[model samples]
Target chain A: MQDIKEILWEICKAPGSPGQEGAARQAVKAVLEKVCPQAVLNDDPMGNLTAFLGDKHSQNQLLFDAHLDQIGMVVTGITEEGFLHLAPCGGVDRRVLPGSPVDVYGKERLTGIVCCQPPHLSDGKAEKVEPVEEMYVDLGLSRAQAEEMVRPGDAVLLHVEPRQMLGARVTAAGLDNRAGVAVLLRCAQLLGGKPLSCGVTFLFSSREEIGCEGARVAAYQVQPSQAVVVDVSFARQPGVPPQKSGSMGAGMMIGTAPSLDACVTSRLIALCKEHGWDYQMEVMGGRTGTNADVIGITRAGVPTGLISVPLRYMHTTAETIDCKDAEYTAQLLAAYVQEKGGALDG
Target chain B: MADLKLLEELCSLYGVSGNEGPVRQKLCDLLTPFADRIETDALGNLLVYKQGKQRPKTRLMISAHMDEVGLIVTHITDDGLLKFATVGGIDNRILCGKQVMVNGHYGVIGGKPVHLMKGEEREKAVAVDDLSIDIGAMNRAQAEQAVSLGDTVGFVSGFDRFGNKVRARALDDRAGCAIVAGLVQSELAYDMTFVFCVQEEIGLRGARVAAYQVQPQAAIVVECTTAADLSGVGAGKQVCRLGEGPVVPFMDRSTIYDREYYELAFRLARENGLLCQTKQRIAGGNDAGAIHVSRGGVRTVSVSVPCRYLHSPMGMIAQEDFDAAQTLTALLAEHIAGHPAV
Candidate 1:
């Protein structure tokens, strides 16, 4: 087994808030270069990155993918008091916005905390959730100083570093996607210089959380015949229903949605069983709520399958994912590719 | 002043979102005389790219939604009354007892006459689910023949003029459409693209795709915004007032405008000697929500005509507000033509 703790740490630590994804994209690109130096790499006008192993041939398995853009705020306005008001790039839990520490990326990185109403000044009402409108960040700079350095449209990220949890789990702000990115890199590392019939393309797409826009354009550009999307799913946690959540540390979940390509998905399940790998089933009544939804119907259509890592507290700063599950996912993707796409082409 | 004849044509159209084909054809014919380059995309956004007489510095996109908030057919009862759903955000209180156009068949949305209401139902606000459209059909068979399931339904209101005031349905944006149509005829100093976008009321879908396709450096969305300047309304609560020129919003629910762009709009208004009002309260959104974030972000702001009782069958706007919207859009384009900042 390879130790990828360092790689995952570097990916989760970089701030790639929505439109400002250069930092995270750069970090992921560096790792891809180191792991698969021979693989052909390319990026689209929208900044969607892809790494291709094997020849660019038809009837192959293409990765539907995950994005590097994380949920954070963009500086929308600066108040005369030197405080900044923000617009959320993707999704940020409104309950977590008040009083949270943030790093605003402007001309220079500015450390600040979201200002909140103190309870002592309240007038006898129970603590109620306030909308994002009432929230602002205090940078402790004068108006002139802030104007000299920062401008509107800058990004602000939650200041939470990845931490080790009990039982080999990890928690951070962007584990919803950075973990998926880590799995793809590890898969490439495992598949380095291997002889294979399957043409595997890893799409480290951008702007997934805001919408499936990044992959929508990528799928349209690539137009791959077959695809497998990697994303994050809800894990068993407090206040979560058992039917909706998967067990952490079990394995990655193979999505079972009516919209998903049944043959390709069943093929994945068959490989997991044959290899004695840990796996689970995630059933959706409609869409799987991933990039596969958009990728499935791009152009005429692309038959797509989905695989998701189980994580708790999605979209929160403290998103938790078991590192073992990520390693297991990487092994499964690499083995599934080596198995000649599990009889779908046959 | 707005040409009442042109305003009449715009306000009386049936251009609901996601189904703008008929409206697009008519609009194309009207713009063909002025448009240097006109093309429609897969998602129904009509891009009318007009080049400048001089060298262009920045690409400008000025847009207005061709779609209006309307109804979608959901179910049909045996009595031929259709159970319907709203296509965009619409208050249920304004829906009851209003006339509607469902796929060419005129009908009336049925609400329990207050005299027929029983007990608490009289005291409660009417919900949309409780309403049905009566198209004078005797049975499900006749209703199906004229209007099939999944057909779009829009409010049925005709344009009327009363002392420089106009009231009509879809004026929320058809008013914006007329303003751009006039701008297309005038000579331009800077190259600009005028987009008639779709599905904006459904959440800026057309603008999102169109902005990506064009990748403009800056954009201005001409729209009609709500005016809550009714009698007894508090100062901090009124969003804007009708007849107060054009309302330039600083921020709204879906977007926060670039400070420089909003200020630029105000500056153009000041230089042109046109009346421009700032929104008193932050509320509704427009295509700026999606346009500003498309393709590495764009500088976008909105110049809206103040509308009273917006998104309804009887929305009202002043002719002078329409004139102000036209002036603000022209001056902004003219100013950018000279300054031309990225």
Candidate 2:
């Protein structure tokens, strides 16, 4: 069996910012092709890749959604000195931007650094974080040379290698959603080559960072009786309240929100208990901040549930998670799909 | 030409301020083969004397620091987080969300996630005091097993070359050290003393002591100074620039360099057809600060490579400028050693 960490590292290494999801989409497809080769895979106009398994004609079809896009920047303009100005493609955190390294996908891949004022030049006081629009990316090239290589609207991703930390924890730039994508791929690995009563369709949706457009469009086409969205949620770190976030290395976070299907959430919790697997409760008052919020209201209002792998340092290059959490999340998902006669009524 | 391969190897070694054992050991190994005598002082400075074809009329000393700016673990929180303080001048804005290596373990400096931050907090920069290094430890006991207090933390950056520029950590002084290393490996015209001093970042403490020990008649401090030629920054604020060759400063925040040596640097560069520039602003200091003020004072001038993003995880320098700094330092050192006292 392919390790989930290996799968996650491969997926996170691929750069896919919002509308530019081709690379990440292909990464997810490669994993699925290796683990679940019997499943039929296809893409939609919006770049959403769907892998279908089991009897497609079954009335009780289930869809799993995970975003393939990550937060990054797009080149907006270039200065006379060749520094490239940028606009955030998603909700990029301004605080962690200064002095960060990035990769600009231009005519060819070029390494760039976010311009940061050296302390010697500053007034030695805590300065306000500059908005991404005001910041520039230094390509270490002259104005004329930079213009020859890079252009406006080129994609730029914060460049940090996938690093294995102590124990099961790992950190990477695209771990925000790649962790979820890896979970779905592992889930497919478990359910592959096995007979199931209901059909399963895994949707590696695109452009979820900008909006839930990919999930919204893909759900309308699949029209499943029930859906579950797997994405990363807040993991407990310093300054984050315990009630608002789950602990890292704990387990899967079974999300409970007003927008979710209660039956599916309960079923997932029940399966975790039955299998002696660990999990934590993620309670939300209103809509869960995931693609589940959009997929639930798709078509004639499909009953959608949410599951998240606890992640820390979101929207930055240091997004971290435990590889064990992803494995357990996959186990819960596989158990949910394999339960006799998979159908949820809300 | 500057040896980029040597510079890359030197940059990869960790040598934060007071914790410069690894850097000192490496330099000793590289210089031992080419030295007349090699000895380390109590303060960990690698003092090497190289005999040449002829003894100089004036005793000359060439200096480059072996230390780089980094962080040190100050405290370990009960939750397995490590609190650190900057060992040297580091921009607080660049501390967050950066990968670091504390001792041998990989860790990341992070604070509250942006989604959890409220009000003006999202737009405000995090102070170094508020950040912590998380190495995936669960509690204080687990963290203690992996790291200890006062452990040096170095930024994890790999050497990269693109176009005419090279980027890596520790380029500030490592580039300077690489230039001196090249000279030590070559044939010289006059006897000279080379001192790779320690803890220069913490206040030029190492150079201060080394100068007192050597007490040369004239000194040449090879360094890498800040070049703020960034986009949108005004030309007046750009103290120096890359690809402009070596920077010879007249006066800075630290020392008013020797008049004769400062002029001599520019004249020598012009005579040799080397690209050279002067710092446009009186900002930033180096070992020249401490070395020039030693007992009875020594005539010292700084010949530096203009570097961008100095004291940060990644610093950039033009290859052409690096080559120029290396050649000019060799030429300037030879002239100073052979010239008679006026």
Candidate 3:
């Protein structure tokens, strides 16, 4: 099996601006083909990529979901000067946008730096965060050159490389859902070694950052009886209260919320206990803010569960997570699949 | 032309102000082969005396800073988060959500997610007091084991060139340093002194002492000045512009530059058919702030490359401007050294 860290870094490196997820979807497809050869792959019109392993005719199918899209900006206008006027495509953190470097996917791949005033140039009195639309991108190009090379609808992504930190921790710009995508990919790799008794469908949905549009449509197409959503939740960092987050590197966070099926949630917990794998409880009041909310009500309502990798600095270029937590998440997911496959009575 | 490869190497090294040992050492190694006499000053300034064929009538010194702005660890929190204070003037707007290196370990700066911020909190930038560097440590003990109270933190950025531009961290003075180093390697019209000063971002502390020690009759401070020719900013507010040319400031916040040398710079650039510009706004200062006032006064002028977003993680400069700055600095140095000013 490929090292999980390498797989995570490879997926995170691909740009997947929301609603323009072709690049990221291609990366995940290549890895899925290598990791699980027996699986049949399919792409829906809504931009969701799905892979089915085992008998597609079975009614007892298990669905796994992870969003492939990440937050980014799109070019809205080019100024009379060479600067690019932008509108963020997803929940791009305005606070981090200033002075951040970006990669513009246009007629050509152009490198740009978001415009910002250093304190020496500004009034130096009140510090304010500019709205995303107000900030301009400087590609170091002339006005005529910019218009010739770029259009209004090109995608722009934060250009931070995925880096390894101390131990198994890693940092990258698109770790929000790519971390979850890595978890699902690793889960498929583990499930490939065993005799699958139940059909499994992996859904790498699109555009979860703006809304669950892709998940809502893709889940209806997959039509699984039960589903599990793999995504990222807040990890304990400074200023974040401990109650609302899981400890990084502690384990996978098995989500418990009102909208989640109690049986799927408890079964994951029991499997964690049986396998002696590290785990944490991520409790939510109502709807877990994940694809679980949309995937649950798909076509007569599929029962869905949530598993999250404890990540720090979400929706920014500095999103970080521990690689071991991904391993823990994959272990719990593979265990759940095994428990469900045993019930097939083959 | 300036040595961009050297500039990239200089920018890649981490040498925040007050801890410029790494940058100073690199400069010393690069300049030693070209220098007749080189030694480090008390405040860590690398002073090199490159000998020419014949000594000129006027004493001359050309200088650039060796230090860049960065963060220093002030305290490690109970949860292993390292609190830091900016070593120089860094805007609070650029401090959040940046990746940094604390004592050679990879760390990231972040605060509460935007989803957790309240209405007013979202409008205002996160103050430096609220931000901390997370280096994947679990507790204070582990953080203390990895980092100390005074370890410096530098931004982690890659040097990249696209179109007619370059982007990287520490380009503020590294571009200047590369220009000066490149000059030291070339044949000079007259013998001169080259000082790569330290702690320029905090204040002109290093240049102050180096000027007092060198006591040259004339000085030229090579630097990277702010360029605010942005999309929304007005033309008057644009201190200088990239791609227009090198900048010669008649007056900035720190010094009223020598009128004769100031005119001399533009005159020489025009005569040589090189693009040159004057700083339109008197907003920034450089080592010229201190050098022009050292010991009965030195006739000093500043030649700068107009840079966008100075003191941020990634600063930008036009490749044409960098080459022009180097050629202009050399021409000004040679002419001033031969002039009968002393």
Cα lDDT tens digits for candidate 1, B1-342: 555677688777787788887778878998988888999999998989887787667678889888988899998887566889999876554565455677776665544322223555543435678767766554578678778888899876556664456766788788888888778878898778899999999999999999999988888899998876543245566688767789899998778987987898888788878888988776888999999999899888888998765666556678888998998888887666556566
lDDT of 1 at A142: 53
lDDT of 3 by residue, A1-346 (tens): 1367878877887888888899899999888888887778899888899988776777778899999999899999899989999998887789888898899999878889999975765675447888899999999888899999999999999888877777788888889989899988998888885777788899999999899999999988888989999999999886678889999989999999999988888888888899888999999999998999999999899888999999998887789998999988887888777776724232
* Residue A82 alpha-carbon offset, candidate 2, angstroms: 0.9
Residue range A1-346, candidate 1, lDDT tens digits: 2356667888887888876788888898888778878677888888788888865664675664777777888888877666787787776665445445578898988766565432222233213434555567756455687787789999898766565543456666688789888888888888879886767778988887778788999888887777888888887643456788788778889899999999878888988898888899999999977889999998998888888888766776557677888888888888877876523763
Cα deviation at A194, candidate 1, in Å, is 1.1
Off by over 4 Å in 1: A341-343, B1-342
User: What DockQ class does candidate 1 belong to?
Assistant: incorrect
In order, candidate lDDTs are 0.76, 0.90, 0.89
lDDT (0-100) at residue A42 of candidate 1?
83
User: Which stretch of 10 consecutive residues in model 3 chain B shows the poorest summed lDDT?
Assistant: B110-119
Q: Residue-wise lDDT of candidate 2 within A141-258, one digit each (tens)? A: 9889999999999999998998888888888888889998999999899899999888999999989998889999999999998898999999988878999899998888999989
In candidate 1, residue A100 scores what lDDT?
Answer: 53
TM-score of chain A, predicted model 2, versus the true chain A, to 2 decimals:
0.97
Query: What TM-score goes with each of the models?
Result: 0.50, 0.98, 0.98
What candidate 2 gets wrong by more than 4 Å, as runs, is: A124-126
Q: What TM-score does each model's chain B reach against the true chain B? A: 0.97, 0.99, 0.99
lDDT of 3 at A155: 98
DockQ of each: 0.01, 0.77, 0.71
Pairs that collide in candidate 1 are none
